[model samples]
Target: MTANACAPTYSLPATSAPLPAPKQDPVRTLIDELLAEQQRLQTPVARFSEAHDRGASPALEPLYRDLIPLSKPGPGEQYAFEVDLDSCTGCKACVAGCHSLNGLDDEETWRDVGMLVGGTRNHPFQQTVTSACHHCADPGCLNGCPVLAYEKDPVTGIVRHLDDQCIGCQYCILKCPYDVPKYNDRLGIVRKCDMCHSRLAVGEAPACVQACPTQAIKIVTVTTHLNGQPALDTTAFLPGAPAPEYTQPTTRYTSSKPLPAEIIAADAATLRPQHPHWPLVFMLTLMPMAVGCFTVAACADLLAPRYPLLANLPASAPTTLALTGWLAGAAGLFASVFHLGQPLRAWRVFLGLRKSWLSREAVIFGPWFGLATATAAVPLASQLGLFSGSADVPVGSVSSALASAYSLLAAHYSLLTLATASVGLLGLFCSSMIYIDTQRHLWRAAQTIPRFFGSGAVLGFAILFAAAPTLPYFFALLGSVLFKLAIEARELRPLDSDDDTPTASFKTAQMLTGPLRLPHNLRVTSALLACILAFALTRISAPSLLAWTIPALLLASELTERYLYFRAVVAPKMPGVVSK
Candidate 1:
């Protein structure tokens, strides 16, 4: 079939001047008009921006007029949270608002609502207390941060965390009496309420302040000092909360009705064990062990010249002890890295040395480690003939000078050992101070100082006796272990007390005997086993076996003790609901 056959021809019947336009439907016309109107309308965000650009007040301004301060703080004053205890309903709306507005994690909340209960049976009283960062005049978190991650604004007095600067050491968590800083596992840093400083800067109420239905939360300017530094009046700070004298907390919790003197935290009786911090446990245990080893090595080296027994011992004993000390110190220091969320950023840990004990510990340990390494290396190098000259070489050759210098260094190695041990002792003191500064009852100077120094002495003597199998070292180890055990036993005395008020010390006793019973028992068993092993070393023909075994037992005991050190201590916190 051709194209012409398939196609049909058509002829025009009439000629037209123009074609008529199609008529528009009423519905279509109305829809087009509505679309045009919609295009001309401004979005809510755009309207908000326009309103601000026109110098108009925000819509919520009227509602939160009295919720926020109208001006910046004056001289000797800073911003603080002021919550009316009478108005708090424990609804946790402030917590929700804080979480949402700050885009916090699902489980993270900067604001918390806690309950305080007390009073006689007839007049039983209960109240919910809303709390956030008090923006203290002397902030413990700021003081204790190794990298200076926290800073208090000089003008506003809001303590702010520098997220990028944080190494996620979590020391601030221990430092804060109120437990304000919340660690963010995802970000590897801690965060807390800045009193919504960003919002307050722009004349807007904080999220919690705005979210309160009853307007119980408000921002106010308070005097930071009365006569001298840290003299802020903390009388109005929440009762049944952590003592405010330490940090000079500025948050005011006021009530129309007088609170009962017997008011106590709802969770007061709860026995919540804290994180064991395995890395810290090992670090604390092993570092002190290294220090002890160094101490024994130095003492042995110094006494060997005068004492026939020490001199008659193996010539390699001092070198062996120093090497062991170096190895332990290195391992302990390396273990500390695992505790950091950002290990690479730990170089900045020295930034807080002026204020933080942790910083001091880190700084002191670095030099001590270097000195220890050198002490260990020099003897090994001499033994390997690294500084020795060839037998055929002349007496005045460069190798001879090197050998002579090495000999001089070897002769004076004890001085280096003494110096290293001294620095290590200082480092251990800093370590003890790190916890002591937290002001926990269980970690007071009386308990912590002896525990730390005693562990060092016991482990040090145990290691020395292992190396040389001497009677003096054996007795020293036994005495130190016994003393340490005695001090630790003091912690358990409260367990047998007739009074059951659940005080901090009593609570610590409960933790040791209850959930932590196994570890506590193991600690004691290890120590006793070490003492038994030491005694057996005197009778056994295979003294070598007992020599190594005693130190192992002592190490196990100290590690368990360190674990319990962190776990049994009852950290101070705000009162909240009873735990299940």
Candidate 2:
């Protein structure tokens, strides 16, 4: 207390007054004033000249003058493009204008000009259609985004991509019908036409609109109901374009000249498969196969006691099953990282789980991986004598109790197996949904679900046959192989005549029979060989050689089958040059 009382008191210092900034030299001050006056006088004339250079003519200015107030739509209103197809020259001025004004990459374009041609030779008809982001009533890009990277303005209905928030997964590119969004590889993000929203906000038309020399492209106010007018119907679209009712695309195309009933895209006959996504192919194949392995082992163990055929088989050790599942699941997941433009930002994949099937796939697979790892680790821990068996000294009944618990856990291996099996199945389902959600004919659930699940079934049974040499397992493997082949064969059948659009069906068939024919033939050959080997392995005493060989053949066949699956898919895109 005495030492505390002896502490010195601090004194409060008086504050000084603030000093004013020094005055500029008279000569410099006079010069600055003169410069300001000169800039003010030059600004008005410069602005008018700038607008004139943007492709606005005297006749177009009145409409341009009136369009500014309506550019940014008010509440419950929406802005859309009205294209007068008759006046469009396919000059590509709009495309160039958008690219330059938006500062897009050299290889990237947000707008495109497509030619629709169809009519009698005597009355020939060809029309150029300029298309950009439709900003649809149901924006697929917005709905499919994993990270909520896309947003449609409630006020103006302008679809905008939030670049900083994007992980560059490219799911939106797949979802968009018009193919408006362009991925910037250097920036590791996606950018799209916002209809020059910044320009619109300042009472100016979009760059594309202003740049149209013939005034073919113009801004208009449309009711929220895209189907509000008959002009927006499917009949208005060019050939090979998706049905307007699907996304209710807001861009309206009109022409005074009557187009033929069978207008076709100039590039409709072009056969181009989506770029081979190697990481996706590996992840899709290996992860499901891993899940199948876990499920088969678990089911085999659970059913072994009940079924006579499953009895006395050489099932994989729990350690092997756990470890295989762990490795396969982890490897598939790691490989998927390379598929993203910004792999470092892959953690954002979970952000779109609510609406994006791609996100759901990530979320579900993550748990599957964790469970598999834990299952593998338990057996490893027991082997290392970390949980049970020979330790230095007994602590108490707790240690003895843990030792007994460990033994019980080791005995009840089916518990972890069942859990891993459950999660693996869920992961497979999520994977199927990733393609199913695209709504592409080739990737429909009827096609993708069966192929995906059947792959797991075939590979899982093959694995089970190897793990435990059993007749039922071999038979199951043989049956699944045949079933999968049947499904693929169905793809060869002529497309349904009753279906409204057969372009996709025709394109898919061409891909399968044309480019992928050799692979398809080899796949069937491999499957047949595997089946023959499986049958022969059952009869021979030393079946180890055949056991390993059959699975290898089966895996090769599966790889080929998956390659075709991706190779034959014709993703819907806006018509463009074949090289694009």
Candidate 3:
């Protein structure tokens, strides 16, 4: 009992004071405070909305404040790009911004940067140029579109492409002097810079303007008229760019220093082949051949009865030729359909008939096809006894009516042939006008008119001679072919000139003799071969074989020539870097 009492005598400790809290690390304490503060902050969307409601300026406002106009354009005025050459450093930030903000394809850019170089050895100079759609006072793309796929805004004067309305004919590409409109392969349509129209509508600068670090590009109001009339003074356009007289481009390039007199594009000497446009090549070649056939058939039908040499022609010859022409025309028209990126939208091609030669060509050819079909089929129908009847049948009877109708058609058949040929000739004129209107030096009226019509004449005479094997047809073929070859040979004259300037003609000459020399030589060789075969046909009797061979050779020559037409011609553009 005593031991137990002693063991129970141990004392319990009293409640101890709280131990001192471990000191917090300074970095951790600061981080915790920041995390709590961040939790209380508003989201970016809420902040932006609050700022907008309070009329606070955007973060980017200061960056693009001077790049855009303070007010909209007034009467006789329009918005245009004004570039300060002295301020530009050739940085491609504008291009990147345009592509990103516009959501353009990876390889596509509305803005382009180029270099201009000139001056003597002692005073060499270089300038960087940035360019995009000029939004001209008179736009060639709008004027040449066969479907009205482009429009200039009435108030702002921005040239905008209507993507949905475009058939992707790309005629506007050829029409535009500065090569502004670009084709989008994925969309099967053309797209261009509309000056970031939607952004401008919301009082924001264009992507290019906003992103240019040096503030080299700016939007400004410019006078689009003179003496109260819509006229443009294009002297303010860039010096090393395409001529502004054609489209009246409004982009103004300013510099403190005067440009060199001999300033030229960096890429002026580069030789590159253009798109072949195979469908157009086929359409052009075949349609002209069809026109020639119809024309020759008409002439033969009219003169055969009067001239003894032609009188020997078989009665089926005219009908055969007309049929051949109709077939060719049909094939050409079909091939043209393939040329359109949006073939289904081509129904609207006639909408631009007021300004577009392509539209006129389409409209005129539609009826020409119908007339040609009738011309080809009517005679065949008569030969098949569809219009045959005894003249002595009772008057007013169907048989008597048929006989009368047949006789009337027989009397006016030559006239019908003449009319069809005339319409086709007119369509061909429209075709030639399509290229001539482009204002390219290689596609001027003098070159295009003769080339198109001459091709028709040569091909036509070749076909007629093949059918009749007559001396007149042979001579006509020889003369027409020789004339066409002579016209093509004139393209080489610039090569012999002492002047070494890289003008369009000189560039064309260089292209023909350079990379395109193989095709050019083949064209000439085929033409000569056709001529030789034509002469041989007169000496030898091999109508079936020579007929096909001669026309085939002529066709090959014409196709090659048309290929060279597109390949050798130098397109005018802004100065660019030398192509690798």
Measured by TM-score, how close is model 1 to the native structure? 0.87
- TM-scores for all candidates: the values are 0.87, 0.82, 0.87
> What local lDDT does model 1 show for residue 445?
97
Off by over 4 Å in 1: 1-63, 227-230, 389-405, 543-546
lDDT of 3 at 191: 91
Indicate the residue-level lDDT of 481 in model 3: 90
Clashes of 1: 0
Candidate 2 Cα misplacement greater than 4 A, ranges: 1-63, 66-71, 225-240, 315-318, 378-412, 495-502, 543-546, 577-580
- Ranking of all predicted structures according to lDDT, beginning with the best and ending with the worst: 1, 3, 2
Q: Candidate 2's residue-wise lDDT over 118-232, tens digit each?
A: 7888987777788898888788999899888888888888889998888888888777766777888899888898988877776667888767777788778766643343333
Candidate 3: C-alpha lDDT: 0.85
Better of 1 and 2 by TM-score: 1
| Per-model C-alpha RMSD | 10.2, 13.1, 11.2
Clashing pairs in 3: none
Better of 1 and 2 by lDDT: 1
lDDT-superior candidate, 1 or 3? 1
lDDT of 2: 0.76
